[model samples]
Target: AALIVCVLVLELIVRQFPAFVIELTVWGLHKEIENKEVNVADKEAEAKHQQHLARFCRK
Candidate 1:
């Protein structure tokens, strides 16, 4: 599915540049929260980012 590809791409980015990806993810989440535009898809992506961040951090 498209969603799986998106997640895989994000995971690859995270693996290559974890710090940058984490910063961007945190900024995006903060902006979404501040604007109260937290849609289901946004939440799902945020969750995926967090999951990937955690996985990478354990390395």
Candidate 2:
């Protein structure tokens, strides 16, 4: 009886382990995408500031 119980527990953990890993992977991907967007926005703001400064100096 104890052996059977152990087998059941092992099976459950094996089946659920992949699901946990997949969730973590997807969450990590989302965080990475969010960071990438932030970087892009910062670059765009810097570019716009540089353009404005150029135009100001031209005047």
Candidate 3:
């Protein structure tokens, strides 16, 4: 639901601004910083910005 939209927005933003992506990764560890990241401190909060992106492996 709303989580999906948030995920999409952050995904796009990270793509456009990679620096923010890194900051977001570490920030996830601290719930307090989550809000500073993007008002996502509680479960009711949007569930975007997952930990891993799951990159593909080509060999």
TM-scores of the models, in the order given = 0.36, 0.55, 0.29
Kindly list the per-residue Cα lDDT of model 1 for residues 1-59, writing each as its tens digit.
Answer: 99999999988887879788789999999998876765866888999999999999999
Model 1 CA deviation exceeding 4 Å by range: 1-38
Better of 1 and 2 by TM-score: 2
User: Candidate 2 local accuracy as lDDT?
Assistant: 0.95
Q: Is candidate 1 or candidate 3 better by lDDT?
A: 1
Q: TM-score: which candidate is best?
A: 2
> Where in model 3 is the C-alpha error above 4 Å?
18-59
Scored against the true structure, residue 54 in model 1 reaches a CA lDDT of 100
**lDDT for each candidate structure:** 0.88, 0.95, 0.62
In model 2, how large is the Cα lDDT of residue 15?
90
**What digit string (tens of lDDT, one per residue) describes model 2 on residues 1-59?**
99999999998878998997898899999999999999999999999999999999999
Query: Between which residue pairs do clashes occur in model 2?
Result: none
After the best TM-score superposition of candidate 2, give how far the Cα of residue 8 lies from its true spot, in angstroms: 19
Error of 2 at 18 (Å): 2.9
lDDT of 3 by residue, 1-59 (tens): 89999999988886878777668766766756656656435533433323222222221
